[model samples]
Each structure stands twice: as C-alpha cells, then as structure tokens.
Target chain A: MASPMSITALASDTIINAGAVDYLILAVYFVFVLGIGVMASRGVSDSVDFFLSGRSLPAWVTGLAFISANLGAVEIMGMSANGAEYGLPSVHYFWIGAIPAMLFLGVVMMPFYYGSKVRSVPEFMKRRFGTGAHLVNAISFAVAQLLIAGINLYLLGSIVHALLGWPLWVALIVAAAIVLSYITLGGLKAAIYNEVLQFFVIVAALTPLTIIGLRKVGGWGGLTDKITSAAVKNGTSAGDQLNSWPGNDISGFSSDLLSVVGIVFGLGFVLSFGYWTTNFVEVQRAMASDSIASGRKTPVIGAFPKMFIPFITIVPGMIAAVSVSEIIEVKAGGSVPGGSSGKGVAYNDALLYLMRDVLPNGLLGLAIAGLLAAFMAGMAANISAFNTVVSYDLVQEYLVKDRDDSFYLLVGRIATVAATVIAIFTASLAGNFSNIMDYLQTLFGFFNAPLFATFILGMFWKRMTATAGWVGLVAGTGSAILVWALTSFGNPWTLPGQGSAFLAASVAFVVDILLSIVVSLMTAPKTSAELNGLVYSETPREDLVDANEASHPWYQRTIPLAGIALVIVVILNILF
Target chain B: MSVNTTQKQHTAGILDIRNVIGALLGIYGVILTLMGLFGDTETDKTDGINANLWAGLIMLAVGIFFVAWVRVKPVVVPEDLDTGGDDPAYMEKH
Candidate 1:
C-alpha cells in the first residue's frame, strides 16, 4: 500500500530542504525584476509619469495589471484556503461576486471617469461633492491602502519565514526594500509593468499545481468522489461542500459559513460592486490606459482572465480539503472549532501545502518565485495607488496648490517611501488575524460599502448636492464603524463577523442613500454649468464618448467583450 | 532643465519593455524546464509532480507569444497628444 501523505510532515521536511537550485532561481528572479525597475524609471520626469505611467499604457498591459493588482500572495493563498475549506461554494467569490461588478465598471462607469479626466477617484468626489467629501475619501482611501498593503506584507513575511525558515522581520524588511527599489524609481510605470509580469508568473506557477493536484485526486469527478467518500467515512454528508447553495441554508456549518442570501447580497452585489467599481487600487490601472476607449476596455479585458482564475486559485483548495489534513491549527471561537483540521483542512496553508508536496525542485523554485512576484506586485499596486492619492488629491490639492510638476514629482517619491514604510509598520501589527480573506473583506466593508452609495448617487443622480455628498459619506462611515464595534466588541452578537460586516455595510449604504436624498432636497442642487461632467444627466453630450461607441468595430468595442464574459459566467454557473 | 518634459522617447514597437522582459524570462524558463524534465531524477522536492517543467514551459510559451504579438502590431505614438502641463486635463485640476 502507498504510504499515507501527512500535510505536516511533508511541509516541515520540504521547508528545511528546499535546495540550492531553488535559492539560485529566487536570486535570479529578484535581480531580473530589479533590472526591469531600473529600466522603467527612465521615462519618469513628472508627477503624471510617476503616478499614472504618463497615461501611456496600452489596454492589454493595464488590463493584466488591473487584475494582477488584486492577485497578491494574500489573495492567492487566502482564496485557496477558503476553496479547500468550503469546496466548490468558494467559487462564489469569483463568479457571482466579481464578474458582474467588473462588467458594470467597464460598461457603465468608465466613460464618466475617463472623459472627466480626474487625477484620482477622490478627485472625482471633489468634482462632484466639493473639498470636504474629497478630504474624507482621500484620507480614508490612503489609510485603507496602507492597512491592506501592511496586511499583504505581514502575510508575505509570514509565508517567507515559514517556507524559508528566515526571521519574519528579515523577510519583511527585504521585501519592503525590493518594493521601494522599483516603485520609488519608476513609480506607477514600474508598478504596472511588474504587475503585468507578475500576472504571467502567477498563471505559470499555479496552473500546473492545479492540474497536478487534480490528477492526484483523480480529476474533478474523482476529486468530488474522494471528498464525498472522505466525508461519508467521517460520518458526515458533503451537502454544502458540493452544492453552491448547500442545504438551501446560508447560516451554520452547511457547506458555506454564510447563507445564500448573505452570499448574494453581502458578497456578490454590495462587496463585489463596492470593490471593483469604487476601489482606487484596482481602478487606477484602467484609468492609466492611453485613450478613453482603451481605458473603457481595461476592466472588460481583465474580466475575461478574471472569470477563469478560480480554476487555479480555488481548485487547489478543494483538492487540499480532501487530500491534506492538519494544514493549520484553528483557535476556539463561537463559529470556529479549536483544533487543526479537526473540523476541516487548515485553509491558509492549502497552497503552501501544495507547493511543498506537489511541485518538484526546479519547478518549485519558479512557483515560489511566482508567489513572491505576486506578493510584490500586489504591494506595488497598493503603494502606487496610495502615493498618487497622497500626491495629487491630498498634498497638492490641500497643502501646496501652486507647485510645479517636478516639485510634486519629488513629493510623490517621498510619499511613496513614507507610505510604504508605514505599511511595513502596520504589517507587523497584523499577526493576530484568523483569516486573511475575512480580515480583508471586513476592511472593505468599513469603507467601500458606504463609498459605493456615495458614488452611485453622485454619478447617476443629478440632484445629489455637495452637502449631501459629504454628509452622506461621514454618516455612512460612522454607521459602518458603529455596527462593526457593536457586533465585535461592545455586545454579544448572533451573526458571524463576516455576516455582521455585510449587514453593517448594507445599513450604511442604505443610510447614506437616504441621507443624500433627504439632504439634497433640503439643500440647493448645483446648477447645470457647475454639474457638467460631474453628474450623469448634466454631463455635456460630447463628453459621453461612448455614445457613438456602437458605431465602432465590434472587436474595438467594450459591449461585446462584456457580453462574452457574461455568457461564459452564466454557462459556467449552469454547468457546474 | 533643457529637455522638454512633454516629449516621450521613441522606442521600437517590437522591443517594447513587455516583450523584452518576456523574452528574457522565456529563455530562463525554458532552461529550467529542460533541466527539470531531462536532468538527474535525484532529489525531487515536490513529492511526485514535475511542477518546474510544466510551469517553465508555459512561461516560455507565454513570453514568446507576448513578444511576437508586440512585433506583429507595433505601438504608434500620437505625436500631438496633449498630455502635459498645458493639456486640458491638468489645466482643469485646479
């Protein structure tokens, strides 16, 4: 009989003896990436070049970077862990949660953003609501990016320390230095180029692991068979693991932690739309495209690759759920069990387990390099977005309005360094989090959930006033925080944190919408001239470049690409 | 101070930065893949899966394809593009 594969033994042994060949490959990869950063820096002369790639990026590059910005080590590792822990239901994040919002961003929102030529998302807020709203958004956005980047850094450092047996501080500092090396020199251009490169690296690394892991479990059908058998032998049913809406129930341990209702509204509509549409970290890539039409196509082009990412990301988790036991140790909680793989696979370590046990030495090095690249690029994306908002929306707008391009360029570089350092510091404080994915989503709820409401009213509704915009934002953010604190710390709650996060966001979004409407009616609405290009109805007809978009060739248009992605998503959902 | 801030340097379309990096990575990827596939079978870190060979081969192909794609359709710079201090976009930011 074949020896039983224990996750702990394999992982411990593999980390200890990763070999010199792998080390060499990693060194070479680092040197090569640094070289690219140096070369990309040659184009930098002004703030625009540093912050937005001089607005010269093509659709394909920006599109790839757009998605890659989100494909950091945390996302890859966290999603994979969720996949193993939750099974096929985990794919709800990609299919139902992500694709629709991406499509909406491309088809509906891009025209206004690109046509108006706002320097940042907060600038759009400023144009629509006034400086108060701008200050609120810019400060919150900058802080959000800092927190997210720090979490990514923390995760990357932990993974490195675990895999290489290096000190976490050493890993963090080295990674931080590498990130600053490129971004500080080339700014957004380097970040974008690296993100595009990292995108390929991620695909090259993870796709093979998914295929190999599947083969080990006897393909998709076999994998399902194994999971069901494993569950049955353990005296439980694979009800929720196999079905997306398992048990027709959303709460409790019925396949997924959240109910179908929660998944649909909280994750799919509210969270997905909030992140994909309004989050500057992802949208900045699309806004950097060379032309208005090209900018519009960025998210659409990204959506095609995005729809299929779950295969490489989540499938491994499903494989690990059945194949690897004792992947992680969970602490005691109301919803969580107090043991390692006692209830299920240790989700965070799913991809790492696969890396240690499945990939051979030479390929293992490349895979690890891919993981590292993803982490770095993810950080770069956040830093790039952070620095831009700091330089343009906050510093230049508020502090030094009459500064020249070179002066602001210097400020941008200094801000990049400052923000990255702060992120590194914040990353050190992220150790106590239970799940990276949950932590990230909760953070998103705190801001994006309410920001989405503000953006929606400001963009589509002509009657939304500046007073309404700022007041709604403040009120909405306050409500989100209040709900979070009440549920988590102040009082005992029935719902899980994720559920509370979703519900809190829903409340904030609703409150913001009602507040905006009520306040706008009470206050004076901006006249047509003041509202031009800011509000949808009041936007000048010529500014709507997409009005004649139908006349463009089908291949050159955004609608067809979006239509294709929607069809594929529907077909996949039905078939699966 | 003597140089024009608005002017962008003209580079060959086939030699776009993406293509260059892709080509370099592809070359290295192919080397690692070949070593993994045909070299000594001793000391495989990944239990039984030849992850290096597959990942490297895929990387090589993708790198070459990106390079080829750029060669086929070179990027043309819009000389009169208004993307500077005097451009309408920046002028309205204030």
Candidate 2:
C-alpha cells in the first residue's frame, strides 16, 4: 500500500489554494490507499479470506481498523458540529456514551460472537432465533448500511466537488469510483488495512489543526473563558455550555434530573450500547482478528484511541465556535447568505470553516485528505459489511443455496458494486438530512436498540424462544418509530435535540426486553444441544475464551487491557 | 480477473502492516519537510509557527519507528489459512 501516489485530480473549485506540495501530499495518501488494496488482494483465496481477511489480522491492526471504521463523517464533521453547538457536553459522545459499551463489547459480547464463528450479525440471528428474525435483521442492517454509506458518500463527494469544481453528481460518482476500486480489488482486508492507515492519516490531519486552534485560543483556560463568556452573552448558563454534567443542551431537556437520566440511560445504556455491541459495521472489524483473544481485545484496544478522539474533533469545533466568522455569526443567529446545506450557515459548517480560516496550503491539503480518508473509511466499512451479509447471509443461505465458494466470492464483488451505485442515489437523501447526526441517531435507535435487546436476552437467557426473537424485534422497532413521530410532530413533547433519539432507543430496549421475556414464556425454546454455541448456558466456558490467553503478557491479554481502558475512561470522565 | 482463482498466492501475512504504514508516512513526511524548507512558510495563518516543518519531523520519527518495529518483530505467515470457520464440533456433535 506504500506505492508512491500520483492521485488523480480535477480543477479545484479553488475554494482553497492548493499548492504543488498540497497535491503531492494528497497524491501520496491515495497511492498508499490503493497500494494496500493491491497487496491485500494477493491474500484472498476464497470467500472467507475476502470477507474476513482470512481471520488472520493481528490485534493492533484490527484494533486501529475497528476505531477507524467508526472515525467517519460522524466522528469528525458531525461531532465537530455538535461541539460548536453544544460545547463541553459533546465529550459525552466519547467518554460516557461510547467507551463503556465498547468495553462491554470487548469483555462480554465479543467472546460470544467470536466463539460462534458466524459470518455476519444477521447469520447469528438466523442460527439463534430462526428465519423471521434473521430476515428482519439482515434486511434492516443492509438498508441501514446503504443509507449510512450514502451519508459517507455524500460527505466524500462534497470534498471532491469542492476540489474539482465538478457538479455534485460527478463528484459523487468519482468519489464512489475511488472507494469502489479499492474494495472491489481487495475486499475486507483492503478496507481494514486502509482503515488503519486512514486512522493514522486522520490523526495526522486533525492534530495540527487542534494544536493551532488551541494555541490560537490561548490554550485550554482561555478557551473555557471564551466559551463561558459567550454563553453569558447568549443569555444562557455557562454550566449548560461548559460543563459535562446535566448537559442541558446535549439532551435538549429542561429539567436537570431528566437530562442526567436521559444521558445516562438513553445515551449510555441504550443508544451507545445498541450501536457498538450490535452494529455489523463495527463488529465485522473485530471478527477479522487473528485469534479469539485478539478479537475480544479489538474493541478494547480501539477504546484507547476512541476516548482521545474528541480532542481533535470536538475541541477544534469548540475553537471554531469562538474563532471562525461564519460559526460565530451562525451562533449569533445569523445565516450564510449563500449557504450550501439547507437552512443556512449550519452548525455542521463549523469544521470546514475552521479549516479554511486557519490552515495554510500544505497543511490544508493534508487536512482535506484526512477528511476524505475518514469518509472513505466509513463508506468502505458499510460497503464491506453490506457485501458480506448479502452474499453469505441472504443469497447463499436461501436464493442460491449450496453455492461453491468461488461463486459466493463473485457474488460479493458484485454486491459491492451494487451497494456503491445504490449509495450514489441515496447520497441525495443525505443532503436533506444534513442535520444528518440526528437522523443517524434515529436510525441506530430503530435498528440497533431492539436488536441489542434480542441479542442480549437471547445470549444470556437460553430460555428466550425463537418466536420471542422476531416478535420483540418487530415490536421494539415499531415503538421507537411511534415515539419519534409523537415527539417531533406535536403535543406534549418531552425530549428535544438528541434527547428524543435517546428516548426512542430506551423505549425500544425496554419494549424488546419485556416482550422477549413474556413471549419466551409462551413459546418453545430450541433444546440445549441445539443451542450449543448460540446461547450462554448451553455453551461451556472454554468455548467462550482462548485457553492459551494466560500465556500472554498483561498488555496482550484481554481482561487486563480492557480493565486498563475502563480505568482510563473513568478518569477521563472525571477530569473532563 | 479475481485473485481467488489462482491458488499458489502466498503473500497474506508476509506484507507486514508496519511496512505499509512506515512507507506512507515516510513519503508524506519527506514531502512536507521539503516544502517546509523550500516552499513559502505560511506564518500568517499559523501565527508564526512552521507547522509543516514541525508536523513533518514528528511524522518522520514515528514512521521510522514503525519500519524498525517490523524488523524487531516480524509477522508469522501460515502456509494455509483454511483454519477460519466454526469449530467442527458445533455441527458434528449436534
């Protein structure tokens, strides 16, 4: 992947003046991206090898890739946007909402998933619950991946459009082609390897911006002073803007008690847990690990970097909120006269405006490439996971049963192309929702919350019946929809901002769990022998973990690493 | 043509992840460092700090570390990676 890059380019809309050095830096990054794909393709010998990197990637690589897959438009632009608007509470997305669930995935959920050896999350559903749940999960997951991929594609295209002065459609196609080539050539290994590289590049791109931004704001103390002063100027409490606790703006709740509850249970328990533990995009990265220990440690290993990401992402947005003219004006309740994405100079414009105002040529180019890398990584993760589910879980399982391994591999490549094309159409849908984070949170609530409930209950309680699985999923999803409509449309609304998304997810989780327990009692369960690897009680302890884990050092071991990560996150929470 | 059709391909674990990371960063570092030396240093935007120079040097150091890391600890490549499925026990025992 280290081949010297001569990245293809079109005329820059000339939004930013990119010197020769800038082009060269971007060129080098793309060359590496494609070179990794070429190198990875050599390793693919069958469908399994293509989809899971032959399940042979080391922990460090998988770990970086795990976080990188998620270090997408959501983490960078979305969180930055949130930071500009919400301030200190935005850190909650990392410390409170994300880390603990990631640790749970590494410690508890991963062993179950790794030991079972299912190709996709939906496949696991089929084996445990039956075709009804399987189909629901597979279809919903596939749809979600496509829609999210579209969001990434939309973000990626925006960059290409700015760079080339191309029409939006052309930029979207060009961006899709760039992503498609690597994935179609190399499959999951390329995606994962590029993700790791993207992780580093993303860090490289953002670190400079964060440092300069912090320096410009006269460091941390100065930043807080400015943010607090601005809060007072806006006629709001500084605590709402500067403190992490209660986080009135983040939850969009007026009552401090309700806000805390909403954040703790809604975000921490339901939404974060739902997405991190059950989403196939993230899970697929861990599943590509070389060993059970490595697989279990993947998310935990990623947590270290994940917890620190807000510094570069949200912190920059905080800097921009006080610094950038556009952001400042938007904060003052004014609009960008010729604003691109909807209502006006949106909160989402915070990062891009900061990048424009502060970064010089060479650094600016590198930063742009970094944003592009994150977008590609996100879209690549979605496409890779989408192809696997379509090929292995749906097509091979039902329509084209008993297909040869080579046949499925071909089907996978085709599915990659299909997902990319579909994503191009869906990219437009992303623009209308440039309050994209809200919709994304809504999606996670609908798809992942109920699914997490089913997975959690079924994994721990072997008595949970297959009938309960399908019924709970359907009911949980419906309840989340119902809540979303009532709150957004009219009378007696309780939550605002992301609070409604969290409320919907919490309701979904409760609905799924309660219905699962009740329906399970009324229905029949698969016998213990049949439930073997699929359920907790039916499976032995040895099956859940690596027997040789004791031989490794404490750092290399899963629990100790996870324990260390948990401690660090707790400290970060208290400190921040 | 798909790579899967050919069987004797054995480059899986041999191409270490470090090598790829090192080479890319090294290229980026060298280019940025060169620009910092020869190109116009945009001090106005960065409040007088040489961002390209400083960032480049740090990236160069880290890239070298990764390259050295591979030499110190190489990845082991299995002759066959056909070991990636459900433990045969799941189906046979059932």
For candidate 1, list the clashing residue pairs, or say none: A81-A347, A84-A317, A240-A255, A250-A259, A359-B46, A363-B52
TM-score of 1: 0.88
* Two-chain DockQ for each candidate model: 0.25, 0.25
Q: Which ranges in model 1 have alpha carbons more than 4 Å from their true place?
A: A1-16, A246-258, A328-345, A432-441, A489-493, A546-552, B1-9, B13-15, B40-51, B78-94
- What candidate 2 gets wrong by more than 4 Å, as runs, is A1-15, A338-343, A429-441, B1-14, B81-94
Q: Write the per-residue lDDT of candidate 1 for residues A121-222, one digit (tens) a residue.
A: 999999888988999999988887887788677667766766776677888999999999999987887888888878876777787778888887788899
Worst 10 contiguous positions by lDDT, candidate 1 chain A: A1-10
Models 1 onward score TM values of 0.88, 0.93
Model 2: clashing residue pairs? A1-A35, A1-A36
TM-score of chain A of each: 0.91, 0.95
- Model 2 residue B90 lDDT? 11
